[model samples]
Target: MSATRPPMTAVGADRLRDELEYLKRVKRPEIVAAVAEARAHGDLKENAEYHAAREMHGFNEGRINELEAALSNSEIIDTERLAVAPRIVFGAIVDLVDLDSEAEVTYQIVGDLEADIKKNLIAVSSPIARALIGKNEGDEFDFVAPNGTKTYEIKGVRYK
Candidate 1:
């Protein structure tokens, strides 16, 4: 049996690709130059600059490999190309309201690598997103948060 690949938005995939390209085409060469310059300074045993450059090179290469594998393994979902639906799903931008505080908030369900809480991009596997999935607008659900259980109402759900 084949293992299911994780889902990722097209925007997230593009961002990872851009980072990979930058690391390969720009950071890699810059680190190479730094290593060469450090090597000219003299003995490798006591050269801090050489050690730092080598460490940076190793980290850059590792990240490039990680990004490549993630991009290849991910199932890119383009929200714009999908059929619009009221129910929440992967890559759906959802608008929600706090029942207790009456506070309004928005979040986009994304892949693990793309989830940024500061930007309100929630991962599909997150507690809130899992609760919101398959639910329609006007539906209410109770979420057990770190603070406490909070009741929320789905105000809207959009594909894009």
Candidate 2:
């Protein structure tokens, strides 16, 4: 069976590796210890602690499996190897100016797994990122937000 996984940048791959390591070395052991301690209390049916521990262990195992599969199938793209133009691309840090307010906002276009809106890291598949892709500086793009259509001008694009 062939499975297709989403592409990931080198930085995103590294972050996933770090998370997997933490889950394996720290979280897994902690959950095991908790389960063992809960089991020692004897009554299995009414053991709230045991049930909670089991639930946590289940979640941890599921996350581990997911991370493993993603990492295994990931096509790591190294930004340094790409001879891209001064336009939006995966792993590019883009600066945009709100046309209406004239306010500047910066976003790092990353893989889906690494996209954190709070950190201003947008996924390549996001609406804003999609509109920004292949756009050079001074190019204006419109976004269909929930409020209304908003336009933004590309101020800059950096590889770092």
Candidate 3:
């Protein structure tokens, strides 16, 4: 059987690379030092420092492995290489207005791995983003949010 992995956008790849660099350059050494210092403290059975350090080491190593695997298998898509259009696609920045509340919000449509709600980056698979797909300016779409169904009007779509 073959394994399938999610495609990562360029921004997601960069974030992953930054995390990997931090793990390798900073976290790994810090964990190693902590483990060594804990080991020097003596009695492994009752050494609180040793146990804590060991736990931290395990977590750090696990994360390192996971990041490495993701990076290795990642399919990075450059946003600049994508064709620009009115309809939503990966890397499209869309401006939306809430039809009910008349509130305005902008979101960048991105890959799953790079989705950050705080930054107004929505994953392509998200309900709102999914509804926005294939829609152009002046179009309206309804999304089922946790509270209830809400409608949004597409104000604009841009590549940048």
Best by TM-score: 1
Best by lDDT: 1
Top-down lDDT ranking? 1, 2, 3
Model 1 clashing residue pairs (backbone): none
Q: Please state the error at residue 133 of candidate 2 in Å.
A: 1.4
Clashing pairs in 2: none
Q: Using TM-score, rank the candidates from best to worst.
A: 1, 2, 3
The regions of model 2 sitting more than 4 angstroms off are 1-5
Winner of 1 and 2 under TM-score: 1
On residues 50-136, what C-alpha lDDT tens digit does candidate 1 reach at each position? 999999999999999999999999999998886756888899999999999999999999999889999999999999999998999
Predicted structure 2: lDDT: 0.88
Q: What TM-score would each prediction reach against the true structure?
A: 0.96, 0.93, 0.89
Q: What tens-digit string does per-residue lDDT give for candidate 3 at 1-160?
A: 9876666778788898899899989998998999899999888999999999999989988988987887778677777777766777778889999999999999988877678999998888888887888888888888898999999999998875
lDDT of 3: 0.85
Pairs that collide, model 3: none
Off by over 4 Å in 3: 1-5
- Between candidates 1 and 3, the one scoring higher on lDDT is 1
